[model samples]
Target chain A: MIHFDQVSKRYQSGHEALRNVSFRLAAGEMAFLTGHSGAGKTTLLRLVALVERASRGQVLIGGQNLNRLAHRKIPYFRRNIGLVFQDHRLLPERTVFDNVALPLVIAGARHQEIARRVRAALDKVGLLGKERLHPLTLSGGEQQRVGIARAVVNKPPILLADEPTGNLDPELSREIMGLFGSFSNFGVTVLIATHDIELIQRMNTRTLVLSKGCLVDD
Target chain B: MRAKATTPHFERGPRFQLRAWLLRHLQTLFSALGELTRSPLGTAMTAGVIGIALALPAGLYVFLDNVQAVGQNWDGKVEISLFLKDQIDDEAASRFALSLHKRSELRHVQLITRAEALEEYRQLSGFAEALNAFEQENPLPALVLVEPTLRYAQPEAIKGLVAELGRLPAVELAQFDLEWLQRLHAIIHTLKRGVVVLAALLALGVLLIVGNTIRLGIENRRAEIEIIQLVGATDAFIRRPFLYTGFCFGLLGALMAWLLVEGGLWLVRGPLAELASLYQANFLLASLGLRASLVLCLMGALLGLAGSWLAVRRHLRGIEVG
Candidate 1:
């Protein structure tokens, strides 16, 4: 559901983060974007998320060209996509339930709908009973699950995760990958940017690799 | 034996849904409030600082208002006194009074003949024995008390009128009671300038105080904001809570200042009344009116909103999520 055509992003200081990157992911497909540090993986995902514009080419999500979207319309465009970060990114002062409910809140769902959806999402991540607990009180795996629940709470069609399992153990990482695989089964397109070769091999999804500022292979 | 339950369908119009969309973002408002509540002490301190800064100028404004009120009450009574020549007789003085009465500049003119003035003064002053001890006729001239029209009560106008009156053959000396009015006008002018300078300096102080507080807030919440942006939250969404926080601070500060000013006026009202009583005059201290209060509150809110907006616009750009 994402297409990047000859995408390039260059910083103001003349450093190129992404160089003529081209990729396409089909609907409901899951992919692992593998790269080292400063390898343009994050830059590519950022382009898809429309947080940063492509410097040279078109980045399309669904059928809409992000480069052509007005700045005021960016928020509406983002509602169809969900993003999870490696750090969980939970507001530490809030409960797990509230953290998971953030996307719905942003989407302006009804209170009852928020409570119902948040509970269900937390249940899917095996975090139902822990909703009242704060993020600081949860383990890294639990916190990551909370972040994942938050990402999918609005039932976004496309889910992007940046190093989702970066801090988890091997077992926890596998479980997280399995969770993403389940999301794919539910027809949600998922692109996970990671450097975990073992996890990628185990999941055996489509793999896109990047080196320096260019996409080397897919 | 139970039948499968069907999901109920409720369809809302697109416009209604759009409104709902806006309503859903109330979380941003709540989150903003929550952030402020997280550090009640800091919020209170910041608001208190703003309140005191605003109160200084507001207090001065109130004081100047009272001064203006007192000046206005005295302005109505301003008049001129004309002393006739010692040789001028009653008929001549009476004729001069009739001429003065014909002039549109004077509101009222009363001719006080020398004998009548002496007898009236003697009866009122309770000094009949001193007047009787005088062997010769008293030297008090025919006094003409002339009340000027409001427009003619000004220093220049009164001076001009006095000169005109002095040229009259029946007059010996003509004096316009304009010195005190001149001094009062000068004082009022100086007060207005002082208010402007003091208000400007205090407003600057308020801006700095609010700016620094907002800066601190940005620093404290930098991480959380980065996370929000990374998760596809727009800059407007991220900036909204800070703006509300600043508004709350300003609003609360203004309210506190209003209270302080009213309290100060209340505390001094009794003494002011007692002092007025000693002077055998009725005086009322003025309080801040509704319009002034609203202006103060609006000022506080705008200051806070602007300060926060500046802080957020400057600091948020430097924080990159990707």
Candidate 2:
């Protein structure tokens, strides 16, 4: 579950990114965050992930307040939330399997357990046969799939994606959305932030639209 | 069921966590080694600097040990000679020697009467013909040679014993070369202290070397560190590989230092033996033995760990999750 109550983020240079945004997504729910380039969709996702703490009010995930979390506990806190970026963020030097296994490794899983989960996650993303191949050698869509596989490999309860299909073809975008849908069906909460209005319309899920620094519509 | 089966399994229990912790450390240990091997030349150069620094003090320590052993050997050969007054005759000197022999501090006492002294002087001295002029008087004084027990054979104890013996009514003088022996002891003591100071400075240098190397390693892997941090890798996990890198540098550097010390000692052994033979003394150069070498390696590893810890603490805070 994810909840934001009057959350606002202001940069050090006095630029306000988000202002008094409020939303709540129940467990196993899937939603889309839609806005233009400077509308704070990324900032919202960052607040939920605790990458950048909300400058005002509260951002909560699974009943834990992001504002009051101690600095040392941030890593453990992030473990329960999976994040994907527009650029895929796959380590180019590592094999596809190693990229997916990162989250499980961070969780200190056993070697055999990691291998098994990584293969299964790769299978979910339709990348099972490309496990040994490096990300640079893979196509753009395939690399994005690897990133999605990595984000879910550890089976985090909540998933956050920032324009994960921004660079993919429309067909690949639909497939990635389908993966998120199936994950939500299995009782995992999923939130996607994107600027592609057409894709958001096609998603047809609970959508929150941001304009300027305000949550204009939900 | 298929979705449920893939749900993350949290391995609980302290024993299981500890085992996993150890397994992760083992993995990092080898991975760090692999990282170093990937940049062989750079690693060797850094380790070589550490080795030379370590070897300097280690060599000096071994040298000091050898010198102290030789000094102890000479300490065993101390002898005090007591010259009797003119009033002390042969029978009186022999009685004095007997009394001195009974003292706990004296190991042995031998009395040489005036007649025996004159005879020894006549046979050894080339002035035997000239000494015949004083044959009637036989002016040589009676002497008692005193050898101190091992405990009292040192310069300080010998000085005290000499002073006590000089107070004897029949003894004209109690003499030993205490000044030269004291000088030798002073030199060795000063050199030992100097070696300790040098060792400490060089150890600090080793720490700096390891720290700098680890700093560079952290800098090169900045992206990887940031990404891992974002993916829920703890600071400990991010720090593990760098610490291991420093450890490898220290361990390998210590091994290098050991080889340098052994080689240096080996090169000097033959020449040192020849020099000892020229002085009519048998001496052997002592190398850093197995125990000492192992200790050196351990010190290296510890220094490496400390250096990397310092570097990581200072630099790791600069990198945060994006």
List iRMS (one decimal) for every candidate.
9.1, 4.1
TM-score of chain A of 2: 0.98
For candidate 2, the per-residue lDDT at A86 reads 92
Residue runs of model 2 more than 4 Å from their true location after superposition: B1-9, B81-104, B110-145, B163-175
Give a tens-digit lDDT track for model 2, residues B180-264.
7678889989998998899899999998999988888889888888778878888888988998989999999999999999999
Clashes of each: 1, 0
In model 1, the number of clashes is 1
lDDT of each: 0.84, 0.87
Off by over 4 Å in 1: A6-21, A35-39, A55-57, A70-72, A212-217, B1-34, B83-104, B110-144, B164-172
Model 2 score (lDDT): 0.87
Give each prediction's DockQ, rounded to 2 decimals. Answer: 0.26, 0.37
Candidate 2 lDDT over A1-218, as tens digits, reads 78999988999999999999998999888999988899999988888878899889999888878888998888888877788889987787889989999989988998898999999999998888998899999998898888888888888888899999899889988888898899999888999998878888877899999998899998
Q: What lDDT does candidate 1 reach at residue B158?
A: 79
